[model samples]
Target: MPYVEVSLPVRAERSEIYPILKEMEKYPEFMADLVSVEVVERKENSTITKWVSNVDGRIIKWTEVDLFDDANMHISYKQIDGDLKKFEGEWILTPVADGTEIKLTVDFEFGIPMIAGLLNPILKKKVRDNSLNMLTAIKERMENRA
Candidate 1:
């Protein structure tokens, strides 16, 4: 398994950031890697979403279930089925002196044991960079939105 965690401090309140995070469909508007997101199903506290993303010219697709905890400013998601063997993580938002600190954690497994050692490191770095880009995009959007 490969895990990647990225955090960013944003000059925005949790109330403002949480809504944007929940609106996964808008991701492609800011996050270039994301091609499309469709909400397959929705509930008061959870949603099933299908996503298509471009990674280094490869098209990766997945369907995930997201659980949102509004009171705690937390969101967790796990892939029901995807290109990767495992894809699950959480987004945590906490208040800080300046604004809010947002963190993202992703745990994934490519399901190839024979070349695991050779591929894991490269995959981990790609995922980490993608995650950081997402956080940076959100930060810029939040800070500049007025």
Candidate 2:
């Protein structure tokens, strides 16, 4: 298994960030390489989303269940259906000064065990880039909102 975690400060409130985070389907518009996302099912504070992301010219698709925790300002997700064998993560938001500290943690494992070890290094870079890209998109959108 490979894990990646990143924490960044966003000049946004928990209230503002939480809603945007729940609407994961909108990320493809702002995030690089994210081509499309569809909401398969949604219930109180939880949703099943189908995503298609372009990486290295290949489109990777996955479906994940997002669990939102308003009180804690956090959202966690696990891949319920996807091309990958295993994928899970969480987004944590902590109120700071006049903004919020957002942290994203991702745990993933490739389907092919033999190649997983060999691809770990490159996979780590992609995960980190994706995480940072996500935060950057969030910050850009929330800050520029009218």
Candidate 3:
């Protein structure tokens, strides 16, 4: 499995940003690589979302369960069914002096043992870039709102 983590500081409260993050469906509006995100199921504290994203021109689709911890301003997600063998991560929001620091993490495996050594590096970079793009998009969206 390869792990990627990216963080951005937003000049906004966690309360304000949490709602935006919780609304995963809106991500496509701000993130270019994201084609669509649909909420398949919603519960009091969690949601099952289907996602379609373009990763370097290749389309990847997956459905995952997102667990929200409102009190801590955190979200954890794991893939139930997807193109990858394993995909899971968490988003953490921590208070800073000026505002909030948002961190996004991605842990995944392509599930191809034979070519893992050859593709992992390229895949890791793409994932890292995508993660950064997501954080940047959120930061821009929040800051611009202020």
- How high is the CA lDDT of each candidate model? 0.95, 0.88, 0.95
Q: How many pairs of residues collide in each model?
A: 0, 0, 0
lDDT of 1 at 143: 94
In the order shown, what is each candidate's alpha-carbon RMSD? 0.7, 1.2, 0.8
State the lDDT of candidate 3 residue by residue for 48-80, as single tens digits: 999999998899999999999988989999999
Q: Model 1, 1-146: lDDT tens per residue?
A: 89999999999999999999999989999999999999999999999999999989989899999999999989999999889899999999989999999999999999889998899999899899999999999999999995
Error of 1 at 95 (Å): 0.8
Poorly placed runs, candidate 1 (over 4 Å): none
- Candidate 1 TM-score over all chains jointly: 0.98
Candidate 2 regions with alpha-carbon error over 4 angstroms = none
Candidate 1, number of clashes: 0
When summed lDDT is taken over every stretch of 10 residues in candidate 1, the lowest stretch is 110-119
